[model samples]
Target: MYPTNIKMKKKDKRKVAKAVRGAIKAGIKENIKLFLNTKKFGRIILAKLHI
Candidate 1:
């Protein structure tokens, strides 16, 4: 959740939504690959999203 002071107008919200969609479409595979390669404490995090 964002703070109340950070108010987003409808137009700005639409632009952000469009950019996020485009980024996800273009970089989803690369993002997942990078995430999987990330390591902490000699262990890897395996995440599953249930839709």
Candidate 2:
């Protein structure tokens, strides 16, 4: 864990945010493949979710 007096620098914060975004993007991409293979009702739900 980080020390109480220590803080994450701006650059490190941006890097963490970017990594998180990439992971989320990958997860959504995987889900999209699964959604495409699902039934019509599942597709409608997926579309409603804006994915």
lDDT of 1 by residue, 1-51 (tens): 766787799999999999999989879866765666686522244444312
Any runs in candidate 1 off by more than 4 Å, and if so which?
A: 1-4, 29-51
TM-score of 1: 0.44
Q: How close is candidate 2 to the true structure, as a TM-score?
A: 0.61
In candidate 2, stretches whose alpha carbon ends up further than 4 angstroms from where it belongs are 39-51
Model 1, residue 44: distance off in Å is: 32
CA lDDT, every prediction?
A: 0.70, 0.86
For every candidate structure, what is the RMSD over all alpha carbons to the true structure, in angstroms? 11.1, 6.3
lDDT of 2 at 45: 70
Give per-residue CA lDDT, model 2, range 1-51, as digits (tens).
766977899999999999999999999988886977587887777778873
Candidate 2: deviation at residue 48, Å?
Answer: 24
